[model samples]
Target: MAPSNRPIRIAGCSGSASDRRHAMAMLAANCAHDPIDVIIGDWMSEGNMTGRAALKAEAMPAYEPTFLKSLEPALLDIAKHKIKVAVNAGASDTQLLHSVVVKMVRSKNLHLSVAWISGDEVLPAILDAKARKESPFENICTGEVLEEWKFEPLYAQAYLGGLGIAAAFARGADIVICGRVSDASPVIGAAYWWHRWQRSDLDFLANAFVAGHLIECSSYVCGGNFTGFKALESKGWEDIGYPIAEISASGAVVITKNKGSGGEVSVHTCTSQLLYEIQGPWYFNSDVTAILDDVHFEQLSVNRVALRGVRSGLPPLTTKVGITAKGGYQAEMHWFLTGLDILPKARMLQSQILTLLAPHRSRFTKLTFTLNGTAAENATDQPAATVDFRVFAQAPCEEDLSPKRFFRPCFDVIMQGYPGATPHLDYRLGMPKAFYEYYVTLLPQAAVEHRLHSGDGRSLKVDPPRETRVWPRQQPSCAVTENGVRLGGFGRTVKGPLGWVVHARSGDKGSDANVGFWVRFRDEWDWLRTLLSVEAVKGLLGEEYNGKDIDRFELPKANAVHFLLHDHLDRGVSSTSSYDFLGKNVAEFLRSRHVDLPIKLLNRGKI
Candidate 1:
């Protein structure tokens, strides 16, 4: 029987900051009162994933598995209440993860709907997609080829928003489990399913889109990191409040937190989250036609905002896609050497570290120096150079050693360098200011033509079949299933062998690949690995991807896979400046992953 709206409650929990146990306990309490229709769990971050992969490669246990193992018990509790759930918990390991959740739900005799959003691995997707001549992606980081993208992906999240959630709900799955869905998508799915709204209902869709954005970052509204923390006091700090959206039929949202929890809900708090990563002027949603405008933040009550004036718009047939390619490994290190004239003191501090690093330069990839601290006025016209109060240092893996090793000098500085330097008085008490170094890469995205098809119905390895074929310039026929669509592409007829070059970008220097695959639809995500493992392209690229699950993939000459996602462009474009445009909301609903600082990074990287 289809679920008729009796005020269907959908709750999502992010596992980035808290453990799965905490999410489970909160779910247990919330479901006791209002048995929720859907529960979403998020637990992946690119930064965290990179670090974990590094740790795993080093054979050290830096990754936390509490969230990974806590799924069963939590689902069991939801099953006890006959509650359905969907979780973006395991990230790209959807197929292997699906069996686990399916078994758990069936064990309790509860129905379940599970899907994994695929195609975010820039490297694999590009090569595979290009080889199949399916929907292809391009590289963005380097104007050059990202061949390293052939490594197993570090992350593979396709950002399935309302569509996947609605599909899961339509299937009568008591629980919908996902690997990486946009935070607000589950709520949006529930609202769309309940209202039976058309894709063109821009106003209503916009309202629902606003609701998802407002409450997507649960803790933000509930006081996890509200800007005005000093103003509010929480009696039950032990248990924080989760967010809820009292969505009206017209799409207007009454954003609220759970009953009896610590946190203040005010216009300021809601506005802060809304504006957290707002970059572009417009904000978009999954429904394709929904666009937010004239977001009026009214403090109707404590922890409540009466949002109004959400507008919708027509959606393009295709959605906007994002393609991330292999940028080099970039890292930054920060050291807090607080003392008098910290600027000069830090300069000397930096020189000392550089002196040691210069000798072992080959170990490093790149090196950069910056000094930040409040300094007096120097009104010269040529730039008026006045250093910031704090000394800042940035080094890339290409120039300097690893970020970890680069920052190790801070310990040596505290122990001996600072003591021997002129600023004996500059030395503060406590440890030598443990300098923390940050590392990242600058990847690029390009555009490429592609196709979509059905799998050969031969194997189930959760990857693309390792098949090798020269995708033709002409469009190829494809097969679509109730589950999802398959993709194929053509490769250049290189002289060396029957193999093809999988280029991460369409440009002459783009990464080349011998194979590629573009798996569309959420249900078929489980078969992505097997699909990549096809016989034709087999032995062309290995299964074990690198740091990210969605490794470097090929893209069109100009844009990344995002160029192909133009179908739903209007959905991502925000209409009014008042509305908060956050990448996390967009990513959850659109890409299945919560992109931290996506709007900022996207703009900075110009993706």
Candidate 2:
């Protein structure tokens, strides 16, 4: 299905900065491409949510000060273009968002229908169910029952999906406000409305999923956090290009930036983003499955990637839950120490430092000690020599003698306190810092669900919505068995003939692994068996390695061979044992065995 009018062109603004202003600016800048249907903006973060809650308590829009004020001119542009706007700028308060939007529409004399898509924030909803003595929603963060604890939420956003946006559109809303929706949700919603894609058309949904992944974070694929940002800046940062998505009915998405805009999109930039900040083989989505291996990016232009071969399979069985828990108290005290045996002296200082707080030590829930540029604790045969140190202590509860009081007192150690006790305390004062503790709980996707409603002119309402849950099964395991198949680390094995090298690489985070590889088309598995085998695969691993130590595998659902290797622990490259080095050996072995055929590696299965 094509758009009733022109393809219902839309623009998305990244959430990190002045989301509303940028979204408006993009629309205004591209005014020449008139009759744009929707403009989406995002401005939600943990901190932003908390800040917005505080503003609502004072009867203000949370984004009023920063976004609303900054985007006044842009909001005017919406009136001029009659462009529908969607944003999470309301943060924790959708009602407040609706009120603000209505007021702005009226003030601008724009005849725009406004709607606030709510119901994702299940904190209050779950709490209400709990008060009713029924099972409040189970924790999505962890599959366990909801723990009995006080929850002060500035925002409890449910990662809503396309259905929510469709309902907003159905309600004749020109503007929609959302809380925490998946970055892809807005794109999905827009595509769902424009193309009228069926819910069962999981393939198109998957295509939309890829499109959202590409452009959801805005400048990311357009050189914002590009690894080759240095080389791209010469093109011009003054007019940094924004990402664009050209989606078709077949669920194919071609990603490109606005023409003439700054920035370049290449294999490096696109591939870098493909694996950014991802944790597991399955890139979790609210509704559809986006098998990363099925997605391919071909450089169509300087800043374009022809994204094809994305096919949706059976949807995942679970939905992810986001839970935040209060952890403990953390205190950091930084000091400039100068002494003969400064390293040894720092060790002594930490002991002395702990002794000073012994009185209130009982109030602590947990204790940790750390130092910068020196070990906070040491073991030795003889009494430790003098050394300088900076120490930090953490506990479960920081309320009593914590952030405000206890941690700050450590700053005086060098002056009046430590000087009075030891002559070796000749060092500068330390900067005292206090930190709050936060813990995360992973609940099964089934634990948290949202209701969907069809608005009846007043407000669309859905209750006891479909259950959304994420199952936390152990990752799958891998094993290699053959006489001639050889493998080794990247360093040991330089070249291989028959074997394909699976190189381990780091994502831009420089912390997590974002490994991907192409699979030969001849490889096959029963789709039905693959669907049922993800959980069963673990059982297979358990049986094989009973009583042994192997943590987890990344077999989300397996039709093809899957492997994961932590980049840090691997020998230069994260690949199956010696299989990497056996490339040449395997080629020879297979040829000798009389199994011959032309073979090639691909980035994705097929486009």
Candidate 3:
């Protein structure tokens, strides 16, 4: 497997652990029309990894089983085309998944060589830190020392680099399985191996890094979740095409999808993906640090977008490590309030709930009672005149939230209650379920045992980057400066949803939340940059921002404003009693907030 000057074409089939079921089949079926070298999927995340690890002790299949399901339908076509496959889907049990995949291939009489990359499971490293009198590392989101965590630790995994995956491919492995590598490591490894890239190929590696990030979420770059979803209506959404990246030896990339696929690839679609789940202009990776400030996208054709101008720098010595702990148990109850006096009814119901739980309130870790909006005024339909009263409670002990102590008492309220005290028809909502909290922190690459195990019993150790650069606690220079906000400058105004003039995408990073907003026009970008100052954004977030720190950055080329809200999701996904569990709807919520829109921009109509 020698290096070639030919461009390496890689495609993505899965975004998350629960991504579409036919993605692999769709991509593999179109291989005859648009041949690709490798098909990759990014299925590892804080929640997925911790959730899978929690099931290991129960003798459950802990690794991501959905990857096998996705790959099964396309196996024959993939085998016929000789396309390589790589994915970080072997969450916590790579060995088990590797054996399962090998057995599948053997049962089908396929000649694919399967290799697995392990050593990312770093619970031992954390235990050693605790054993040697060393203080636990500070949490990545809040900077609080891990010593403050009271729960018993469950699992820890250090994010691995792509070199091991590259080593596997170099050894002629057709399919590579990984445990907890970074989300983009599969694409990075495929490109690195295809071009015979070296450790010092910073700029080249950076291109692959950005390329991986672009397509790492599969159809996300093909209008799957684009704000311009109306455009996708005509383009077809049911089977939106997955993304493919064509990388030249010099590391330039062109993003495209299969011909006549049920999706459109444009600059806006790519830009939306570029702005998603990213903190600042400088996106870091284990192989190289990519400077996205100058990175730009150009719509080359109907379904092809060219990406370029990605500058690079030395790799970081550390990568993100996720630690999972048994937080406790959580339960939720949904009660609906219909028609008039919604506020008084909500207050009465809440008062009754609090009174009922007062005896065991001390056992509760957190209780979130939300009266989720009022019904429409004199509404036409019965459903429109109904609102949800939700109760989410978490406790360290199961008895605190048991049916008798919790649900039964609350259920008793209906008899002595507010006019229409309707609980969700399903009584199971109040049943306490075990939950795990995930803490993210930086781990030194040297502490990891990154290795590749190929067929024929050969093992290869992939070393860390030769040179590393240290980043400051805050990189203010990496972000663009915001001018003063002048509430009125564009024209005569009208109050409306921000979504009318802007498009947004948001997601979570551990307990922190990341949101990005962009406009369809350059004039709107001017107004957006000045209007969305850090203070303005904090104000827009309203209660969600409640004194939390925020990091704001601008991507001039992408015409977007990005904000990182620290510790906004409480204790990450598992323990947080939040409406937006993973903060995926933060941007949508902000977009729904009313704001003064200039008539001139309003004339352009909603995006």
Name the candidate that leads on TM-score. Answer: 3
Give one digit per residue, the lDDT tens place, for model 2 in 1-607: 1246344555656644444345566655566663355666556544344345455545765553445653556766665666656666656666665677678768988676767666555555545655775654443222235545444433344566666676677566667777666667777777777777766777788778777777766666776654345666688865666677766666667777666778777655565455444444455566676655544566776666777566665545544333333333444455554324554555666666677777767776544444334323453422232333445444544465453445544544555434323332322222222332111223223444543322234654432224333434443343421221222211132223222312111231111123322222323222212322223323432322223222222321222233232222211111112222212122123212211112233222211
Best by lDDT: 3
TM-score of 2: 0.67
lDDT of 1 by residue, 239-283 (tens): 567776777666767767766767766665665455433211244
Candidate 1, backbone clash total: 147
Ranked candidates, highest lDDT first: 3, 2, 1
Model 2, runs deviating above 4 Å? 5-8, 17-23, 33-37, 46-65, 124-145, 148-155, 237-240, 314-318, 324-331, 336-349, 366-399, 402-405, 415-457, 462-472, 475-607
Distance from true position, residue 44, model 3, in Å?
Answer: 1.9
Q: What's model 2's lDDT at 408?
A: 45
355 Cα displacement, candidate 1 (Å): 2.6
Which is superior by TM-score, 1 or 3?
Answer: 3
Off by over 4 Å in 1: 5-7, 15-20, 32-35, 48-70, 106-125, 128-157, 234-238, 316-338, 368-416, 419-607
Model 2 misses residue 476 by how many Å?
4.6
